[model samples]
Target chain A: MSGTFIGMPAFSPPTLPAFSPPTLPAFPTAAKEAVRNPTLRRNLRYATHTIRAKRAAAVSELDDWAALREAGRQIKDHTLRHLDRYLLQLEESVTAAGGVVHWAADADEANRIVTGLVKATGESEVVKVKSMATQEIGLNEALAAEGIHAYETDLAELIVQLGRDRPSHILVPAIHRNRGEIRDIFTHEMSEWGRPAPEGLSDTPAELAEAARLHLREKFLRAKVGISGANFMVAETGTLAVFESEGNGRMCLTLPETLISVVGIEKLVPTWRDLEVFLQTLPRSSTAERMNPYTSMWTGTTDDDGPRTFHLVLLDNGRTDTLADRVGRQALRCIRCSACLNVCPVYERAGGHAYGSVYPGPIGAILSPQLRGTASDIDASLPYASSLCGACYEVCPVAIDIPEVLVHLRERVVEGGPAVRQGAKVTLRPARGHAAERAAMRAARWTFRHPGALRAGQRLASGTRRLVPRTLPGPGRAWSATRDLPKLPPEPFREWWRRTHRPGGQAPADRQEDQR
Target chain B: MSSRDVILGRVRRALADVPDDDTPYEVAVQRGYRRAHGERSIGETVDLLAENLADYRALVHRTDAARLPGLLARLLAGRGARSVLVPPGLPADWLAGELPTRVADDAELTPHQLDRVDSVITGCAVAIAETGTIVLDAGPDQGRRRITLVPDHHICVVRVPGQVVSSVPEALGRLDPARPLTWISGPSATSDIELDRVEGVHGPRTLEVVLTSED
Candidate 1:
C-alpha cells in the first residue's frame, strides 16, 4: 500500500495482476478449474436458472418483444454506422448542458486521463459506481498506482472489492459467490476499507446488504469525486442514464461534487425516444425486472442537485477495430445484459472467469477476440469455446448472433487475415496453435472431394475395425477424454448397401428393422 | 492527432462500406410494440399502479382528499418517526397538523443530517402504472434529489388520474429530461446475492406511495 502521509512517496504497484488482467490461461484450462469447483458450479447453476426462468417470463409478457429486439438491433447498428457524427453531436450536447468531454484511444490513455482528472480535483479518494468500462481498463489498479483509492459502491462490486476477487458476471458480478462467502468477506475485510461489518453478521442476504450499505455510506457521503459508466447516453439531450437495483448508484452519482463518466463511445442513443426500446429490453433481459429499483438520469450537471462538475470520457480501446469487421460488428450492439451467458451451456459448465475478459460467455467469446485480437492463446481459444449452440442468440436482447460471430472469428483465427489493431489495420499470421486443426480440416476437405479414395479408406478402416480402440491417442486424446469414440462397422456403408438392395436384390430384414 | 480526430477517422473508415441510402432512423425501426400492455381506464390504471407497487413490496395506500391528512399522520405515527423531511411545495393540507417535527429541506441539511431524520414526504412528478414507477424530478414538491434519497422512509403522494400514466412512453412524454430525475419502482433493492431479491439497501428502506383520488 502507498505510504499514509500526503507527501510521502507512493510504493510500486502490486505484484498482483490488475483486475480483468490482460491475459489468462486458455479457455479449456481455465474452464477446467471452474468445472472442478462444485461450489462455483452449484452457485452458477442456481443463479442462472433463476434468472433464465424469470427472463423468459418477463420477455413473454411483452407481445412486442421481437419487434423491440429488432428495433434495438437496428438502432444500435445505425448509431454505429454514423458514430462519428453522433459522437460529435453528443459532445456538443453535453458541453451545452455544462459538462466537459475527453477522448481516450485506449485503456492506458483512459487511465491517464481519469487519473489526471482526479488529481486535478485535489482529491485522493473517489467513489465508484459499478462500471464495466472502468473494470475493463483496470482503472482501480491504475488509480492505486497514483495513490488514489476508488471505493466500489455497488453491493455486488463491494462484495467483489472486499473479497479481492474478480467479477464473474456482468449484471450480477458475484453470481459465483454464495451468502456464506460474502459474510466471511465482509467480516474480515470491511474494517480495512472503511466501516467494519456489523457485529455478528449472518449469512442472511438482507443483513449482509445492510452491512454493505453502512460500510459504503461513509465513503459515499464524503466522496469528493465520483466515477461511473452509463447504460445509455442520449446525443440529443446530452443525458446519461444509469440503471441500477440498489441505491448505491444513486448515492455515488448524486453525493459527490465532481463526477467522471468513463463510457464506451457506443453507449449512445440519438434521442430520449430511442431510449424507450432499450429501457424496456435491458432491465428485463438483465435482471428480469419490469423496471430496475432506480434509474438515475442527469444531463450534464444540475444546480446544487448532483455533481457540480461532470467529465465524460469516451473510450475506444479496440472498438474501432471491432467495428471495422462486417460480420463481427454486431458484438458492438450488446447492452451487456448477460442473457447470453445465462443461457450458454458452456458458461453454465465453465463459468464467467474462464473467458478472462470483463466480457465472458458467448458475447465474450466473439467480443474479446475482436476487442483484444486473437494473437493471445485465450483470445484465440475463446472463439472455439462454444458448442455452436444457438441458445445465446435466441436470448440476446439486441439479437446479436453470437454463434455466427464465433464462427467468423474462428475463420479469422485459422486463416491469416487483415484485422484492425489499436485503430490501424494489420495483417495477422494464422494463430500458431490452430495449425494442426487447420491441416486436419484441409485433409477432410480433400477426402470429401474424392469419393473413390474416401470409399477405399473407409473400407480399409472397416476391415480392421477391432484394432481401433474406444478412445483416441495423442492430440485426439483431448476429444475422447470425456467421450467414447464410435466403433467402426465390420462393413462399409457402400458395400452394405450394394449387398442389401439393388434391381435384383431385396432390403435386408435386419437392416429394415434397424431403419424402422 | 487528437484522440477525437483519430477515433472519428477510424469510425468513418470502419463504415466505408455503407451505401449512401442507409435506412433512415424513422423507417429503419418498427416500434410496433404496444404503447401500453392493455388499454385501461384512468381508475383502472391507478389500480394497476397500486397492485404492481405492492407486488414489488412498496406499500400502497389509497385515500381521498378529506382523509389524506389523517392517513399520512397515521403512517408517520405508525412508524414512530420524530423528525420528518418536508419538501418545499408539497400541498399544505396533505400533511396538515402532522405530529412530527418538520425538518425543512434546504442547503444546510447534509445527507448525514437527513439520514438522522426518520422519514421524508414528497409529491411525485409522474407515476407509470405498467412498471409501477414513481418519478421524482426534484420539481417544486420533490425539493432536491437528496431529500428523497437520504432518509430511510419515503412517503410519496401521487394525485391519481392526473399524475399517473399507463406506460413508460406516456410517462416520458410528461417528464422533462433536464431535471434530475429518479425513477423508483420500489425501495432500493438488490438481487446481487445469489440472485435473491432483497429490498432496502442504501436508499429509503421502506417506500410508501399514497394514491389520492382527489387531484
Candidate 2:
C-alpha cells in the first residue's frame, strides 16, 4: 500500500467534540457520513452477515427456542419487578460469602467507588474485561484522570485503545477496521504500550491474535487489579457469571488478586437455575455457539482460587430511571448479545458510531435516549433512527419488543411528556425541530376523524389538481429532497370503493366481469 | 443520602408496578427447555462429550483405566514436556514417572512458577456432553483454578460415564453453586480479532481431555 492514503481518519483518534456529549453530532449526520465510507460499510456488512447466519443456525438447534425466549422474558421481567428484593438478597448472599458490595446511583459515584477501591489496592494499572457497564461510566477515562492506566485485554478493545478510537460495535468494538487496518494499528501502537509487535507483521488474523496475546501476556501475568462486568448475577446463590469466547477474561478474572466487577442492578436473576435459560440463549444469540469457550462464575473470594479481594459495584447510572418507565424498562433485559445490531438494516449501513453511545443499533435507539434521556439532539433523534422493521425484536433473546419501545420513545420526544431523569421526574418539551411533523400528524388525525370534510378536501384537491405542483414547498421540502412525490390520482380511492362495493351502486366493469 | 440508599429506594419505587403477592422462584420462570437435548444412552453421552470436546479444538483421547498411565506417559513424551504440574490428588500411577519431572501443586507455586511448567494434569468435577465443557471447581483432584490456567497445556482426565452429563442444566445440577466454577469448553479461544475465533490466547492453548473408561 502506498503512503497516499496514510492520513485516513478511520484509525485515528475520534475528532468528536471535547466534553462527554460535547462533540457527538446528531445521529443522522454521523450515520450519513458512515453510509458514505465504503470501507466501514463493507466491514459492518461482512461481520454482521457472518454472525447473523451463524446465530440463526445455532438457535435452530434448540427445539424449544420460542419457549426458552418466553422463559427468558418472564425471568427478566420477574427479576426487574422484584429488583429491590433481589438486589438486597444478592448483597446479603455476597456479603455472607465474604465479598463486599457497593452501590452507585450514577456514573460519577460508580467511578469514585471504583477509583477509591483501586487506590486502596495501590495498583497504578489494571487489566479489564470488555464490559458495556464500564464503558458507559467512562471508568477508564475517570481512572486515567487519577493517573491510572487501564489496559483493555479483549483483542477488539485493544485495537480500539491502541488506535485511540471509540468502540464502534458492542461486541466487536473495532468492527469498522479491516485486517490491514488492525495490522497497522498494532504495528504503530503496540510499542507505546507494553510489548512491541514483531517486525513486519502481516494482515493474517492468526498473526494479529498472536501479537495481542504476546503483548497482553505481560499485563495479565503481573497485573494485580482487574476490572470486569458480569453477564448475569444470580440473586439466590450470590453468583456472578461472565460468559466469554476468549481466555483473556479468565486471565483478568482469575489471575488478578483484586477483581472489581461493575455490574448493573438489572443483571440479577432470581436463582442459579435461571442461568440454565440464559446460558443456552446468550451463547446462541451472541457468538452462535452452544457455549462460549470459557464461562467464569465466582461468588465472592475463593479460598485459594481466583481473586482474593472481590468487590462488586452495583452501578445504576440511569438504569433506575429507565426502569421507572413501565414500557421502557425492558431495555434493562438486554444481554449485550448484539444480535439486534447484526439483524438491523439501519445498523448494517449506518454503523454503530452513529448511536453516540456505547450501545448501538435497535437497542441503542431506545436505550441511549432512556439512559441519557432525550434532551440532546442525538439522544432525541435516536428514537427516530429506524424503519420499524421488527427484525430486532425477532432476534432478541429476551424478546424485547423494540419497535414498541421505539414508537413509545418517539411519542415521548415529539409529544413531550413526563419522564424520569437521573432520579427525579421531569417534563420534556416537544423538541424544537419537530413542530412541522407534529402539526402534519395532528392535521392527518383530524381529517381522518372527519370523513365528510376529508372527502370535500379530496374533491377540492382533485378539482385543482392541474394547479398542484409535483414537488412540495416550505416545511415539506426536507421530505421531498431525497424522494419524489407520487402523482395525485384522478379520483379518490374512497369514491371508487363506493362505486364498486356499495350494494345499491352499479358494479364497476371489473366487478361485473367477476360477477359473470 | 448515600448512593446505596438512593439506589435501593429507586429500585423499590421502580418496581412499584408488581403485585403484592410474593412469587416463588420455581413458578416465576417456566423451565420448558430440556435437561438434555434428547435421550442418549450412557455410552452415547460419553461419545457425544468426546465428539463435542474435539469440535472446539480440545484434544480428546480415549483409553481404559488400566492403560491410562502408559497413555499419559506416551502423550507427555510426545510433547517432550520436561516438567508436568501435578495436582495433589491426581492418581499417582497416572503419571508413571516416565513423562516428566512432577511439579506438585503447593502453597508456594506462584503463577510465574506455574508458567514454567510445561503441562498440568487434573481431574474435572463434571463434563457436559452437549456443550463439551469441563467444569473445574478447584476440587482436590482439580487443585486450584490457577494450576489449570497458568500452564501452557492442560491434561484433564474425566472418568467416562460417571462424570459425563448430557446437558448444561444436568451439569449445573451436579455442581455446587458456591464453589468457584470455571466451565472451560476448549483451550482459551477469542473471537475478539475481527469477530473471528482464534484459539490459544491467555489460558491453556492446548487442552487434552482424557476420557478414561474403567473396563
lDDT of each: 0.88, 0.87
TM-score of 2: 0.94
Docking class of 1: high
lDDT of 2 by residue, A255-310 (tens): 88899999999999988888888889999999888889989999988877778899
The best candidate in terms of TM-score:
1
- Badly placed stretches (over 4 Å) of model 1 are A1-23, A497-516
lDDT of 2 at B50: 94
lDDT for model 2: 0.87
- Please, what are the lDDT tens digits per residue for candidate 1 over residues B1-215? 89999999999888887776556667866777777888798889999999989988999999889999999999999999998999889889887756699999887767778779999999999999988999999998898888888889999999988999998888888888888889999999999999989999999999999999875
Please give the DockQ score of every candidate, comma-separated. 0.80, 0.74
Task: For residues A1-516, write the lDDT of model 1, one tens digit per residue.
Answer: 556753222543232245343457899999999999999999999999999999999899888899889989988988898899899999999999999999999999999999999999999889899999999999999898888888888899888887878888998888889999999999997876767899999999999999988888877777789999999999889999999989988888888889999999989988788878887899899999898999999998888788899999999989998999999999999999989999999999899889888788898899888988887889989999999979999999899998899899989998979888987889989888877778889999999899989999999998898789888877777878989888787777787788778766655876855443
Clashing pairs in 1: none
Model 1: residue A29 alpha-carbon error in angstroms: 0.5
**Top-scoring candidate (lDDT):** 1
